[model samples]
Target: MVIALPDPPLLEPRVLGVEDFATKRGRKYGTVLVNAESHGVVDLLPGREKELVAS
Candidate 1:
């Protein structure tokens, strides 16, 4: 049997942290969103493309 867990809820924040880091080191990159106020991780994106970050 297999089980999956739901992701944590995201709430409106006064301070947010957005960071893009290289995965494969220059070959690939990803984005990370954090709720800076509570110092909790919000979400991670597959790529750090400019269009992806804008939305």
Candidate 2:
């Protein structure tokens, strides 16, 4: 008999911490979650565009 493996858990949208954001953005840059105060969600723009900003 063969056993079946369960599927991986789906990723929920949320504000990424410093390290996580950097990895996802593919660069070491400063980025503050737009909803850092409340929902803490950081939804990337369409096409995964990167933006530079001065802190």
**Strongest candidate by lDDT:** 1
- On TM-score, the candidate that comes out on top is 1
TM-score of 2: 0.20
Residues 1-55, model 1: lDDT tens digits? 2347675675787887999999676899899989888988778888998789778
Model 2, position 8: C-alpha lDDT score = 51
Badly placed stretches (over 4 Å) of model 1 are 1-10
lDDT of 2 by residue, 1-55 (tens): 2357775564554544322245545555334435434545454332322543212
Off by more than 4 A, model 2: 1-4, 20-55
Please give the lDDT score at residue 10 for candidate 2: 47
